[model samples]
Structures are given as structure tokens and as C-alpha cells.
Target: MRKITLTLVLILLLVQSLFSHLILQENTAISTTSQFDTGDTAWMLVATALVLLMTPGLGFFYGGMVGKKNVISTMMQSFMAMVIVTVLWVVIAFGLSFGPSLGGIIGNPAGYVFFQNVSVLTSWPLAPTIPFLLFALFQAKFAIITPALVTGAFAERIRFWAYLLFMVLFILFIYTPLAHCTWHPDGLLFQLGVLDFAGGTVVHMSAGWAALAGAIFLGKRRTPNTSPARITYVLLGTGLLWFGWFGFNAGSAMGANGIAVQALGTTTVAAAAASMAWVFLDKIWGHKPSAMGACIGSVVGLVAITPAAGYVSIPHAIFIGIFSSWVSNVMVSKFPKGKIDDALDVFSCHGVGGMTGMLLTGVFASKQVNPAVVDQGLIFGETTLFLHQLVALIGASVFAFTASWILFFVVNKITPLRVSQEKEELGLDLTQHGEFL
Candidate 1:
């Protein structure tokens, strides 16, 4: 165990040393063309804060759904990402994600190691009004939450330290490449004109597939307790997640412009519509309209509209919400939980919801909403964008799921990923962290 840990640390240090270089000799080297705009900058700062808040919100959300003995362990998984991923992002993950293009596949790790060229004086090419440092900070929040979202799958059975190792590997290999592909200007998906207004593909889809991999890898928990630890915690987390989603969707516009306003409106209506649709659907299915159903439905709606928030109209956003909610709800109902044991249905809500949203974006996206769209959606009689979205969805999902399963296997080899049967019965709060609620 000590040898494995030492080897991993040494490898990381070696990579850091190899990539470390000064990309900017002086701040004057930055582009003079992009002028600073205070209004956009201010809004982005707020947006960054809102996005960061979602991690702890996710903690509460996942924590409440796990057994009481594992509550702290579950929430800590989310909180730990804020610390671990933040440091990694500053060190090399950010550059690996958004640095200069490397053949349209990934960023050059040497381009911005240690955020060497990122500064208040500089700005990202995409978000010209905000400081490059601020842009990096905002993106770091997304990186932080992706692995955190996976915790819900194997919530009660994962070893804390092993999970940390898996998180690091997953970010470096899986998340960064996907983010680069979907978001960076010169990336393959971006060049192919794949539209992801926020992160239906980059964040939610990756997390969802990774969760499925985790559920399968970790197997079923020893105790099959399904009752949530606290419904109130789930509600509190839902409130925080909904509030923070405005920033998640609107903030993707990278400016406080009309596009951002449209995104906010769409995000709002989508969540509301999905929440209502979920409860009504529950009644139709003969189940009582439960708060848990409402929360999950709203989140699924948020996930579905994310890729289309800025590209689709208000009414189309509602349709995306309704359709995504129904699909995810059905997926949750039909999932083989007794065998696969995705403790919180993360794959159903996030993976299926994100895919639904991505495809619907191809159906509802309009050039009228954003002139950057090269082609209108299928509804406007164009098939090109829809085809591109479908191709991208299948490709991205395959990569995410395959890479995540390999990561789980590698991490398990280095250190056991699942707790022992004895430890599992004791609960992770005691066995993993020696703390409990």
C-alpha cells in the first residue's frame, strides 16, 4: 500500500515538473483587442459563487439519500472534491483542459501549467470580459462537482481514500478530455459544431456514466436499506441546487447579455415544468406525489435543458423539461436496482436526462436564439445539427463509461475500492472516517 501510494505521488510530481514552464514573460503579452467590461465581469463573479455553492448542495442531496450511518461519509465525498480538484486544477488539470490545442484532441499541458499565464489582466478568448483567472475559477467549480456527483452511486460501500484516488484519475483522464472536446474552441466536438450551452455532455453525462460504472464495479451494498436518511436534507439540497442552477445555465453565456437572460428564463421554467410533470406522472403511476420525486424530476429537467438553455426558446425549454423528466423517471423506475444497486439512481437522472437534453437541443435549437448556431434544429427543417448531436452523444457516452470503468479497475488494484463486508456492515462513517451523524 505504501509503495503504491508513493509511486502515484512520485508520478504526479514528475509530470508536474516536466510540464512546468513560464507561458507568459509579462502581463503586457496579453491581447490588447479584448476590452474589459465591468458589468460582465461583476455578473461572472456572482455566477462563479453560485456555481461553487452547488457542490455542498450536492453533498446534502446525496447525503440525505444514504443510510444514517453513512451520511457524513457521503457528504464528505462531495466536500472533498472542492479541496482535491481545486488544487489539481491549479496545478495542471486546468491547462490540460483549456490550454493551447493539441491536434484538436486535448490541451497542451505545458501551455498554462500552474496557471502561469492566467491573470486578472488577461481574459479567456471565449469569455473576453472576465479575467482569465476568474474564468479558470468558474470552470474549476464544474470540475469539482463532476466526481462529487458520482458518489451517489456507490455511496455506502466505497472506501474514502480509494475513492479519492479514483476521483483524481477520473478528472485527469475522463473529465478533462471531455471538457476540452466539448468546450474548447479548437476541440474536436467544438469544430464539429456540437452545441453544449452548458454541460449536458461534459459534466452530467460523464458523471452519469461514471456513476453507472461505479455501481457495477462496487456491486450491491450489504444492507439494502432504501429509505433516505432525511427527506428534509434532500429538500434543502434541492433548494440549493435549483438556486445554483441559474448560474450553471446562465453563467455559460460568459457575459451578462441577452443570451444569459434567455438562459436564466429557460432554466427557471424548465425546472418548474419538470417538477410539476413529475408529480402528475407519479399520480398517474399510482404513487403518491412525493417530495423526493419532485426534487429528482426538477434536477432531471435541469440536466435536460442545460445543453439547450441558450439555443432553445422558452416553450421549447418546457418541452425539453417535460420529456426529459418523463424519460428519467421511467429509467429510475425500470433500473435493476436489486442487481446493479445504483443507490440514488444517479445514472438514470443524470445520464439519461443529459442524453435526452442533448438530442432535444438538436430538435429545438434555433439560430434565432443564438447566431453562433451554424444550423437550425430539426424542427426548423435542418437535419445537419441533429445528426451531429446524435453522433457526439453516442461517442461521448461510450468514452465516459469505458474510461470510468477502467479507472475503477486501476484504483481497485492500487487500493481496495470497496469496503470489506465487515466494514460495510459497520457503515462507512465509522469504518472509513470514524465519524457519524
Candidate 2:
């Protein structure tokens, strides 16, 4: 009996040792899987900062175009988005945009509520070399700027409190669904293989359509159109926007790889080409080549190339720049001002430019540029990718415009969307915020 008991004790010790070894090995495997590349993490950090700068750049951009009385109000609208969206993202917006797919229509809000699984130890599936937390932060910058873009359409006439409510509703309903559909792996558009290198579709198109809805819903401003508040501010904003776009386009590559370099190159060339093209077009049309034209044109080019930045060659990017500039310039020059009051022509520059870029992406995308291109663009004699892109464009446009209009209507019911005629004539700065230039 003593010998049997001693044998049983030896067997139990052996089992415990094996179990401990297995646990250590499992922990090691998990650590290896979560290990992040220092280079990628560092680059993403810089890129997030770069993208954040674009909002202030955008604030200046929109602010300069409005009347002097509304300059602060216009800028405050853009600045406000940063604060509001940042808080919302930390709480639940990130989860709604990027959580586990809920049947591919939208992300499951419960998946990452309050950032449950988003941690330093976790890695996003697509951006495997970076911490999942970093990816979420980078995406938050994108969310911040989107609602800000819509402010340009209704600048100088919108009720401040009502506009704030609309921004929140738009993000919760309109923006999240579009983001989930376009970026998430299980998203309908992503699964359909529609490639938006950055945010040509997700950011520009949505903002553009929403701008149109706002312009139509609010009607024209009571005050007559006037010269920009400050051309110098517009120039400064353009410089900032051009500088920050490098991150906006290159960072979408999600790594410090050759693709990022290629995106940077295309972005630079596109903006330069577009700026010159706009000036030249103005000269051809018997109009003086104005500083404002150059600024607007460069922005349009940036908007057009966003979807194609990492997919097309530099030469193709130049064409996209010039073509999109021409299209937007014409739209701006000939816009039916009597029917619609798109202050600063947000729809012309962003909506039209984004559409032009999306179509051109279908025409110019090449597998040689990016391996992710399973179906080459139309130039490569393939129709499948282009067809899919067209379908996605139409689907995204209809959804954004209709949903945004409804949100506007809902917000209007809760609180008036447009300010009273007296407030409008008094200017948003003095009436809304009790300050003026």
C-alpha cells in the first residue's frame, strides 16, 4: 500500500508540471501574435497627428469664405466637431463604425462598447503591425473632419444648437453605416471589392451629398453674397490643407511601406497639377486667374485622388487632378444659384470631385500598383471592378443623401434648422455666439 501511494504522488507531480509548461507556452504564443512593429506604430502616431491638423486647416478654409461677421462662427463649427466627435468616438462611435459586423450592414455596437477589446495588446486584422488602439485613434480623426465638412454648405445661416444636434445625429446614423460598409472587411462594399484608397467615398461623397441636402433644406441666406472674409486666411488654409493631405492619403496605407511612398507621390503631383489646371481654366474662360480659384482647384484635386491614391500610377493621378478640377470649376461657375444656395460650393468641390475620383479609380486602378487589386481597372480590359465600383457609388450616394435629409428633417422638428431672418441678417457670429469680427 505504501509503494502504490508513492507512485500515485509521482504521477500527480508529473501532470502538474506538464500543465504549467503548457500554460507558459500558450502565453508566449499570445504575446507573439500581439507584438507590434515599432516602425509602423511610430509612423501611425505621426499620421494621426497629421490627419488631426486637417480639421483646423478646414476651419480656416471654410471661415475665410464666409462674410467677416460669420468668420468666427464658421470656424467654430469646424472646431466644435473635433470636441464632439472625439468624445462620442471614445464612448461608442468607434464601436459602431468598426466593431464585429452585424450582417454587413453595420458594426455591432456591443462589440467594442467603451473600447472593451481595443487595447495595446490587440492588433487590428487589416493593420496587423499596429496596436488596435492606434488604429482606432487614426480612424477617430477621420470621423471628426467629416461632419465638419458639412458645415460649409450651411455656414452663416444655421442655428448653432440645431447644427450641433444635426452633427451628432448624422454621425450616429449616416456616417457610421457608410464607414462600416466601406472599410470593414465584412462590409458590403468591401466584400464587393470597391477600393477607396482613402476616403474619397466615405468622407468626401457623404459630406458633399449632405451639403446639398442642407443647402436645399435651409434655402438661401437672407443676406446677399459678398467677397470672402479674408483671402489671406483662404491662402493659409490651403497651405495647411495641402501639407496635411500627405498624411490623409499616405496614412491610409496603414504602414511605412512602398505603398505609402507611392501614395505620397501621387498626392503631391495631383494637387500641383490641379492647382495649375484651375488657374489655366480660369484664364481660358476670360476670367482673371484668382487666388480663390487656385485654392478651390487644388482642394478638388485632393478630393478626386483620394480614392485612387494608392491604386493608380502618378501619371494617372495628374489626369484625375486636371479632369476633376475642370468639372468642379464648371459646376461652381454655372450652379443654379436661384434654386440652391450651397455657400462656398461644398457640393461642387467635394461631392462632384469625389464622384469623379471614384469613377476614375475604376478606370485607372492597376494590379501592378497594389496587389490587393484582384480585378484590374477598365484600362486593363476588365469590367468587373468598374461595374462594382459604379454600383457601390450609386448605393452610397442614395443612402447618404436620403438618410441625411431625413436626419435634417428630424433635427428640424426637435429644433429649427435655419435661423430666423433677423438672426440671419444680424450674422451668425453676433446672434449665435454673441461675438463678431
Candidate 3:
């Protein structure tokens, strides 16, 4: 069975490589005429690298939280995404996500398959200030990390091959459509004036709800390992995520301008506020505050600020950070105590934080801060924007949750998702990868 799956994967990779070679040959002549700004181009180049770094940062964040026996497996999931998702994106996923709209639901895959027309010489029509190639690769990083985030929910037990299959499906069906709907020009949500400065809906909400679905479908672990292996790793990961986030959020402005400056400024304030709020929440609950608690708190803050990064002022950002941290800290504590084995609280931090941050964006968004703001937030006396945000949130949550659940069911039917009880007991590093911490 292992050989069959491995052979299939290799075959797919070979086909993908051939397609890439074809695109490379075709790409030589498809030079773009769009003039680019050096400042925006330079910023986007750096931003792309920073966003790509987040996946490895996620590896540390999640890897340190799993048991010693599962650390390599945990980290490898993120690393695998870095490898696999880039190829998938280059081949077709990017077109499915950002191609010309199809009824505001999906993009035309034929347009971008193998990146046939993607060009370094042209400024992206979407951003117009940066190279189209940079835009594609940057978005690819976002795609890569989102699925990697789901590994946290069922860590320590899931078969890696089953996971790779599910990752492909989820990226194609779930992540692509959600992104096209929310971020693509002429997308249903974009046309309706739903603002997502970064990827609250496309990344966090989708990954979070999918994590919830995986937990439900996979069932509980035989003996759940709740304690994290290394809090220091989590802290280190948090710092990396926080640093990369300047590029993640500010970079989303698609240029290094005042909006990017505002995003960078708000990102700092929000994370700091949330970290402090998290530790304080622990003390209020009669538990001693710890470094891990602060790290998680800070991440929740970063997640919450993602959607609101460019739309709100620093003060509102601070509130967003505190409120999101409080909600996630509560959920993280209460969620795992239940029957479900979301090993590392992916839903609690990413899902809950993303939703909270997105909704709050509607509360604090203003045209004064970002001229691109078509509708002011509820605080600016426009309930319409708030209502729009709510509807988008509900829509994204339902679709991601439902589609992911079905994908898990289908993948499980093809191959057992969880390993044998004996292999699982011995840990995935040895049984799955033949390596160990």
C-alpha cells in the first residue's frame, strides 16, 4: 500500500515537472508591458520572502507543541507544504484562485495552468505596482501555510499519505474558491464590499473550520498528548510569526505606502496588547501566567489583527488584539477539555481569532484610514458594512467546514487516515517517517 501511494505521488510529481518545463519554455516570450514602481516592487520582493518564511515559522510553532515522539512529523507537515503547495500553485491552483472570475465563484484554471502567461516584467493588474510573478508567489505562500495549519488538529496520529491527498483536495476545492470569492477582483464578496485586508477568511477561517472538521471526522486519539513538548520552540515560533506578519499584513497593502505603514504600526500594537491580555487572563483565572500562554496570546492577537490591519487605526487595533486574545484564550482552555482531540487548538487560535478579528474589522473600519474603504464600519454609523462582514463570515465558515468534512470522509475511504494503534503508540516519527527527535 505504501509503495502504491508513493509511486502515485512520484508520478504526479513527474507530470507536474513536465508541465513546469513547458510553462518555462512558453514564458520566455510572454513578456509583460506593465511598468512597475521600484519602491512597491522592492517591498513586494521582500514581502514575498517574508511570507514564505511563515510556513517554516509555523513548523516551529506547531512542532514545539507536539510530544517529543511527534516533533519531526509535526514539523515535516509544514515543510511538506512548502514543497508541495508551491508546485501545485505554479501548476494550476493560482489560476483557480486569481484567474478571471467565473460567476464570482471560481477562476478559469486554463488561464494560469503551468503559469503559462505569468510574467516578471509586468506589473500585476491586481496590484499594478508590483510584478505579477511576485503576487503569485506571495499568494502561494499563504496557500501553503493555511493547510499546514490544519495538521495541528490531528497531529500525532494521521497517516501522512492520507494527509497529502487531503491537502491537495482542500487546497483545490476549499481554499481556492474561498480565496476567489473574497480576494479576486469581481469576486462575490469583493463586489459586495466585504473587506479582508489580509486573509482572515481565506486563510485562518478556512484552516480553522477545516481543523474542526478533521477533529470530528478523525475521532479522538487513543491517548491524547495534551502537553506541549517545548514551550521555548513555541515562543521562538511566535516571534518569527510576529516578525513575518509585518510582511504578511503590511505587505497585503500590495505596496510600501502609508497604508502599509499603518498596517505595520497596527500589527505591532495589537500583538503586544494581546500578549499582555493573555497572561493577565491567566492570573485572573487563578492560574499562573507562563511563557507559552503569552506566546499563544500574541499569536491570537496577530490573527485577530490580520483582517483589520489596514482598515482600522492603532487604538481600534489594540482593542481588536485584546478582545481576540481573550476569546481564543478562553476557547483554547475550554475546547481541549472536551471529547474532541484538536491536539494543539488550531480552531481555538486560528479559527476563533480569525472570525473575531474579521468581525471587529467591521466595527472599526474607516474610510479616513484607507481610501479604498468603500463602506465605513459600524462605528462610523454604517451597519451595512458590519452586516456584510457578518454574512461573509457565516458563508466562509459554513463552506469551509462542510467541504473539509466531506473531503476527510472521501480520503479516509481511500486510505486509513489514522495509523494502526501500535504504530501510533510508537509515535509517527518512527512508524511514519523512520526518524525521531
Candidate 4:
């Protein structure tokens, strides 16, 4: 009897060990599937901060270009954008971007309020190491700066209240849909294999075309003869913008990987090449290169590389930079013919540069750099990619321009789009704020 009891006890112990082993294997599999890494999380955190800095950098860039009288107002527009867009993004924009798909038109509203399905531990497919909230903030910066770009069109003219209303409507109706179409995983553009690695078409091109519409509707600044308030401020603003752009491009990689390194390298090279191209072009056309030329060239290059950063080779990036700068320069020179005084030349630098980059990307993308990219190459022989690129460029431009034009007209009809002529001469600082700098 004693022997039998001992044997039973040993059998029970063996069964318990077997169950423990199975549990251990299951846990290991779950951890491996999740696979969140420290390095990737750290990099995403830094990148998020970097993108946030670009808003103020843009503020300075736009602020410096406007007449001195409107400097404060220009700066205020950027500040307001940061605040207003952040609110909108948290409340609805984040949901519309990354929430469950709604037949590919927009994201579902289930997560619209944020911190619902999102938490410190929650991860997104876009950046698995980072919380969904972090990714949302990173994208919010893009949304903020885009509308700020439009302020250049009607600077020193539009009322603050009217501009605020326009931004709200624009964010909801225009920006959100474009973002959903281009960046969301199930987005039609993404499904169609349209690659906009960053925000070339979505951010820069959209804003540029909208600026054109605003300029047309608002009419020219009160005094077309006035010069920029402080060239020094413009130079300062330009430097900051150039510096912040590193994060803008590299951070798009969303991880600390070879792709991120490649993006950074290409972005730096493109900006340098374009700067030189602009300087040489200016010298060839007239005399010495101006600060304005250098600043504009750098920005154009940055804008151009935005979509192509991770997909193209370094050499291709250089070509894109030089080509985009030249195109933008030419466009700027002839902008007067259109006679729409886009005060800061958003259309020339962002609009033309973005369009040029998108087309050039089609020409330059290679399967050698990223074998996963399908329909690759233009010079190396794939024509389908080029055709797809053309379609994206045309589609984005047409839709953005047409929608913005109608929006501008509607806003103009309901409320005046520009400040009075007398107010313009005095400067926005005094007219709008009742305070002189």
C-alpha cells in the first residue's frame, strides 16, 4: 500500500511540471510576437520632440518674411495654428488618421477622444515601440505647420477670427481626408502603392495650392511696394527651419534603423546641393546670390526630398535637389506675371518644389535601394511607377487647388478675407493688436 501511494505522488508531480513547461512556451511566443525594443522606443520619443520644434521654426520663417508692421501678426498665426490644431488633432484628427477604416475615406470615430484605446502601453502598427499617443502628437505638428503655410498668402490682411474659422473648417474637411488617403494603412493611395514617404503632397503641396487660392481671393497686400520687415529675421528663421527639417525627414522612418540613417543622409545632401544650385543660378542670372535665394533654395530642397527620402539613392537625391531648386527659382521669377502677391512665395517654394519632387521621385526611385518597393525605377526601366507618380501629383494638385479655391470664396463671401488698406499700411501689429513693436 505504501509503495502504491508513493508512485501516485510521483505521477502527479510529473503532470504539474509538464503543464508548467507548456505555459513557459506560450509566454515566450507572446513576447516574441510583440517584440517591442528599447532602442526603437527611444528614437521615436526623440523624433516626436524634433517634429514639435518645427512649428516655432516655421513661425519665425513666416514671421520674418512679412512686412515689419505685420511681424507680430504673422508670428501669432503660427502660434494659433499650434494651439488650435493640437486641440482638433486630439479631439478628432488622430481618430480620423489611425482609427479603424471607414471604407478608406476616413478613420472611424470610435477613438476620436483619445486615451480610449490609447495608453502609455498601447502600441501602433506604424511605430510598434511607441505609444499611439506619441505618434498622434508627432503628426499633429505636421497639421499645425500646414495651415501656417497658408498665412503667407493673406498676411497683413485676414482677420484673426476669420482665419481661425477657416483653419478649423480646413482641418476637418480638407487636411483630414488628404491625410487619411495618403498615410493610413488602408488609405486608397497607400493601397494603390503611391509612396509619399513624408508629407510632400499631403502637407507642402496642399498648403502651397491653398496659399495660391487665398492670395487670389484676398487680393494683393495693401502695399505691394513694401519690403520685408527685417531681412535679418528672415535669415534667422531660415536657419532654424533648415535645422528642424532633419527631424522632419529622418523621423518619418519611425524607427532607429538603417532606413532612418539613410533618410538623414539623403536629406542633408539634398539641402546642400540645392543651396549651391540656387547660389550658382542667381550668380549666372544677375550678380551675387542673395540671402533670399539661399534660404528659398534650402526650403525647396527640403520640400522636394520629403516624399523621396527613403525610397531613392543618395545620388538621386542630389539630382532632385538641384532640379527642384531650379524649378522653384524659375517659378518665383515669373510669379509676378500671375500678379497674385503670395507674400512669402509659399506657392513657389512649397507648391512648385513639391510637385517637382513628386515627378522627380518617379524618375529616380530604385528597386536596388529598397527591393520591397514594387513597380520601381524610371531610368532603370519601370514605367508603371512613373505613371502612378504622375497620377498622384495631378490628383493631389487638382483636388487641393479646387477645394481651397471654393473654400476661400465661401469665406470671403461670409466675412472679409483681407484687412482694410489703411490697416495694411500701418502694419498688422498696430492694426490688429493695437500695440506697436
Candidate 5:
């Protein structure tokens, strides 16, 4: 065990050293080209705070849903992401994402080392009304939350120390590259005309696929207790995620503008519609309407509209919410019989819902809402956007799944991922965290 741990650490250090000099290009920097707007800046500041809060909210959400013995361990996984991912972002993760382009696959590793050339005085061109530093921080909030989201799929079984190592590896390799491809200006997916209003492609889809990989790699829980610890916590988490989504989706506009307003509106309508739809679907399926059902449905709706919020209308968002909630609901219902165990249905709610949202965006998107939209959706008689989104869905999902699966597999070999059967019966709360309810 000691030898394997040492080997992993050494390999990590070697990779970090190699990456520092991977691709340095100073001449390709984007000059500050616009003045900052106080309103936009303030809105973004607030939005960043809101998004940051969602991570803790996610902890509560996951904590409540897991078995009592695993609750603390599950929530701690999210809290760790908030801490660890920020350190990585401040170091080099941010650069690998938003720094100068490298063949459209990644950013220059040396471009934003220690945020060298980045400053508060300058504005990010993509969001010219806000300081570059602010942009970086807002994006950091995103980097922090993604890995936390993946913790849901392998709640009780994972070893905490192994999980931490996996977080570092996953963030650097899987998450960073996906963010670069989807959000950076010169990225391959961006150049392909794939429109992700916020993170249907980057955040949700990537996290969703990675969650699937983790669940598959970790295998099913050894013991049988899978009941939720607290449904109220799920509701609270749902509310927080739903509320933070206004910032998550609208803040992507980077300014207090009509696009942000449109995103905010769509986000609201979608959650409402989806929650309503989910409850009724339960009724039709012979199950009584329940708070847990409503909460999960609402969140899936939020995930579904995240990619289309800036490009679609309220009515479109409603349709998206209704359809996506039903799809995820069906997945939750049927999956109990499946071999794969996605504990909290991360892949079902976020993965399938993200895919549903992305395809719906391709169908309903319009340049009228946000001129930055690459093109109109197929509803407006253009098929290019639809095709591009499909490519992005397949490409990003496959990349995340393949890379994460291999990473988990190798990491497990180095240090076991799933707890031993004895530890499994003991409960992670006591064994992992030395806590008990």
C-alpha cells in the first residue's frame, strides 16, 4: 500500500513538472479592449457568491440522500472539492482552461501560471464589463463544484484519501480539458459552432459522464441499506441549486444585460415546469406525489435548461423542463433493476438531462435572445447547430467517460477505491470520518 501510494504521488509530481513547460506562448495574449461596467461587475460578484454557495448546498443535498453512516463522508467529499479544486485553479487549472489555445484541445499551460499576466485592472474580453480577476474567480467557483457533483455517484464505498487523489487527477485531466474545449474562444467545440449557454456541455455533461465512470468502476455497494437519510435536506439542496442556477446560467452572460435577464427567466420557468411535470408523472406511474420526487425533478429541469437559458424562450424552457424531468424520472424508476448502481442518480439526472437539454437547445435556440449564439436552432430552419451540438454531446461524453474510467481503474490499482466489506458494514461516517449520528 505504501509503495503504491508513493508511486502515484511520484507520477503526479512528474506530470506536474512536465506540464509547466508544455506549451508557452506569450505573444498570443488578448489585450484588454473594453471598460468595466459597475452594474455588470456587481452582478457578477453576486453571481460568483451564489454559485459558490451551491457547493455546500450540494453537500447537504447528497448528505441527506445517503445512508446515515455515510452522510458525513458523502458531504465531506463535496466540501473537499471546494477546498482542493480552488488550490488547483489558483495554481494551473485555470490556465489549462482559459489560457491561450493549443491546437483547440487545451490552453497553454504556462499562459496563466500563478495568474502571472492576469490582473484586476484588465477585463476579460468575453465578459469585457468585468475585471479579468473577477472572471477568473467566477470560473473558479465552477471548477470547485464539478467534482463535488461527481461524488454523488459513489457515495458510501469510496476511500476518502483515494477520493482526494482522484479529485486532483480528474480536475487536471478531465474537467480542465472539457472546460477549454467548450468555453474558450479558440476551442475545438466552440469553433465547431457548439453553443453551450453555460455548461450543458462543459459542467453538467462532463460531470455526469465522469460520475457514470466512477459508479461503474467502483461497482455496487456491498451492503444493502440505500435509503435516504433525510428528504428535507434534499429539498433544501434542491432549492439552493435551483437558486444558484440563476447565477450559474445567467452569470454566463458575464454582464447585467438582456441575455442575463433572459437566462434568469428561463431558469425560473424551467424548474417550475419540471417540478410540476415530475409530480404528475409519478401519479400516472401509480406512485403518489412526494417531496423527493419534486426536488429531484426540479433539479433535473435546472440542468436541462442550463445550456439553453441564454438562447431559448420561457415557453421553450417549459417544454424542455417538462420533457427532461419525465425522461430522468423514467430513468430513476427503471434503473433499480439495472446492474449499474448510480447511487444518487447523478448520471440519470445530470447526464441524461444534460443530453436532453443540449439537444433541445439545438432545436429551440435563437440568435435573437443572445447575438452570441452561433446560429439559430433547427426550429428556425437550420440544421447546422443541431448537428454541432450532437457532435459535442458525443465527443465530450465519450472523452469524459474514457478518461475517467481509465483514471479510476488505475487509481484503484494504486489504492483501493471501494472500502473493504468489513469497512462497508462499519459505515463511512465512523470509519472514514470517525463520526456517528
Candidate 6:
């Protein structure tokens, strides 16, 4: 009886030891994952806040361009986007974007109804410190701005109820899929090596193209365009956007590393150069440079450098900022003649500027800036990066323009996309919201 009891005790001890070892191994592996870092979390938090600021900045940017009678209505468009988009993101849109891949076209349904299994510590491919939830909020800000950007094209027009309905469907079907294809780790476009860095193509190009489509569908705002409500608002919004963009660009690095710093510096330089370039272009065109031009010019520079922020040098950024601004300015000037009245010129600024940035990124990206492509350069030494950039630009533009055109037409048919002519002339503030601006 004593011998049997001793044998049982020994067996129990062996089992306990094995279980302990397995637990230790599992813990060790988890600890070593690239996602475990405080610095990354902190950076992402800041990035999220920065991106959130852009919505208000965008509100002011668009607000200042429209007549005072519609300023509140215009600003409300962006505000509503923030609220509506966040809800959509958490419930369905987020899953469709970052969930498990479905044939590399979109994410699976696993992450739908977020908060079921996800937490703040969930690791994403780029930002590991934050939970998938945080990433969702960060990306949500991008999604919000995209539809808001379209508001600029249809400013002072479009029924608020109709716009709200359009935005809901647009986020689910349009923005979510594009985001997945461009940023998801297993995304088809990502696999193809399309380097957007910070949404030069995904965010800006998509919004730009969609804006064009919306403008086409909605027709033009009321005639006799009035001066902006407050230039001060525009400047304030510009400053905020500039400040927030650091988070937008640098935060994309997903780490507090040298790359993030480089991206920040390049972003600043490009904006400055682009501002100067716009001023110079205005002078050459025999027009006195306005404060609005300076602000818009800086924004153009920022848009142009977004794709190249982490992939190119400061010198290349300067050239990109200058050249893109020139192109956008010309486009904005001539766009009206084509019978498309882009109210705030969202297509000219974000669309044309983003395209220029993507193309320039191909021409300017060097192996030195990004070691991932060490054998590639664009400064008369390597040409493959340029070709890669060109492919990205063509692919993004074709997809954005084509998809947007179809979506707009379909939505327009289902429900009237534009407001009645009388409502538009009466101003959205009163006609849509029953409020005085």
C-alpha cells in the first residue's frame, strides 16, 4: 500500500511540471511578439488624436469657402460624418476592412460587431501596441474625412437626409473595401507593392474621385459665389491640419523610430515648399497671392508629399510639393470650364495633388529612405521604384474613378442624389436643417 501511494504522488508531480513548462513557453512567445511595445501604443494614441483633429480642420476649410448662409450646414456635414462613420466602423465597416481576408478583396466577417473578442491590446500589422479597436478609431477618422471631403464638392447643395444615407452606404461599400485592399496585410493591392505611405492614394485619391462624382451628380451650387464667411477660420483650420498631419504621416510608421522622424521632417518641408511654390505660381500668372492661396497651397504640398513621406528625401519632397501645387492650381482654374463645378475644388486639390504625389513617389523614392527596397533608387541610379510608383498611381486612379462613377450613378437612381433647384438656391441651412446660419 505504501509503495503504490508513493508511485501515484510521483506521477502527479511529473504532470504538474510539464504543465508549468508549457505555460512558460506560451508566455515567452507572447512576450517576444513584435506587437509588444509601449512606445508604439503611445504613438498610435497621438496619431488617433491627430487624425481626429483633421475632421474639424476639414470643416473649417470647407466652411470658409462657402457663403455665410451655408457655413453651418457645410460644417455640419463633417460633424455628422464623424458621428455616423464611427458607428458604422465599430459595427460593420471595421470588420470588412481589417478582418481576416476574403480572397484578398476585403476582410471577413469575424470582426463584425467589434468588442466581442477584441480588446485594446489586440495587435495590428502596423500598430501592435493598441488594440484592433484603437486602430479602428484611427482609421475611422480617415473614413470620416473622406465623405466630408466630398461635401466640399457639393457644398451648399444636396439634401442633408440624402447625404446622410449616401454616406452610410458609401462607407460600407466604398471606403471599407478600398482601405482593405490598400492597407490590409494580406490585401491584394498591398501584395502588389502599392506604397501609399499615408493615404495619398487610399484616402485622398478616393475622396477626390468621389468628390468629382458627387459634383457631377449634384450639379452646381447656387450662382453668384459669395466670399467666405471668415478667413480667420480658414487659417485656424489650416494650422490645425498642418499640426495634425504630423500624426497622420509619422504615426503611419507604427513605431517611435527613425523612420517616423524622417516622415515628419519631410512632411513639413514639402508643405513649406509647396506654399512658396503656389505663391510663385500666382505671381507668374499675374494674380496677387491671397492668404487663402497660401493656406490652400500648403495643403496641396501636404497632399502631394503624403505618399512619398517615408519613401523619399527632403529634396525630392520639395520638388514634389512645388510641382504638384502648380499642377493642382492649373487644374482648379480650368476645371470649371469643363462644366463640372467642383465647389471647393476638392478634386483639383486632393485628387490632382494625390495623383501627382503618387507619381512623384515613384520618381523620388530611394532605397536609402526605405531599406525594404535597398536595391531601388530614383535619383538617376535606380528606376524600378519609379515604375512601381507609376503602377500604383494608374491602378489607384482607375479603380477610384471607375468605382466612384458607378457608385454615384447607382445611388442617384435609387434616390435623388441632388436637392431640388429651389432648395439649393434657398440654402441648405434653412432648406435641409430648418435653421438659420
For model 1, residues 1-437, the per-residue Cα lDDT tens digits are 66766886688778657655445454447665667899999999999999999999999888888888889999999999999999889888998899888887788877677777778877888988888999999999999999999999988999988998999999999999999998999999999999999999999999999999999999998887657899999999999999999989999999999999999999999998999999999999999999999999899999999999999999999998998989988898899988999999999999999999999999999989998889889999999999999999999999999999999999999798988999988888999888877
Deviation of model 5 at 72, angstroms: 0.6
lDDT string for model 3 (316-347, tens) is 99999999999998898788545888888999
Estimate, for each residue in 158-194, the C-alpha lDDT of model 6 and write its tens digit: 7776677778777877777888888898987777777
Q: How do these models rank on TM-score, best leading?
A: 1, 3, 5, 2, 4, 6
Best by TM-score: 1
Tens-place lDDT digits, model 5, residues 370-417: 787767898999999999999999998899999999999888887889
Model 6 score (lDDT): 0.80
Report how far residue 205 has shifted in candidate 2, in Å.
Answer: 0.3
- Residue 413 C-alpha lDDT in model 6: 74
**Ranking under lDDT, best-scoring first?**
1, 3, 2, 5, 6, 4
In the predicted model 5, the residue pairs found to clash are: none
Model 4 C-alpha lDDT per residue in residues 1-437, reported as the tens digit of each score: 24643674576457446554554444344323445677877887787777777777777877877777788988889889988888777666777876778887778744444334455555677678766666777788888888988888778888876787788777877788788888898987777788787888889889999999888878876576667777777678777777777778888888788788888888898988898899999998895878878877888899999888888999999998999999998888888834787878889899889888888778878777766578785888888878888898898889888989888777767667777778777787888887766
Where does candidate 4 clash, by residue pair? 157-419
Candidate 4 accuracy as TM-score: 0.89
Flag clash pairs in model 6. 120-131
TM-score of each predicted structure versus truth: 0.96, 0.92, 0.95, 0.89, 0.93, 0.88
The TM-score of predicted model 2 comes to 0.92
Stretches off by above 4 angstroms in model 6 are: 1-35, 374-377
Q: Which sections of candidate 4 miss by over 4 Å?
A: 1-35
After TM-score superposition, the amount by which residue 314's alpha carbon in candidate 5 deviates from its true location, in angstroms, is 0.6
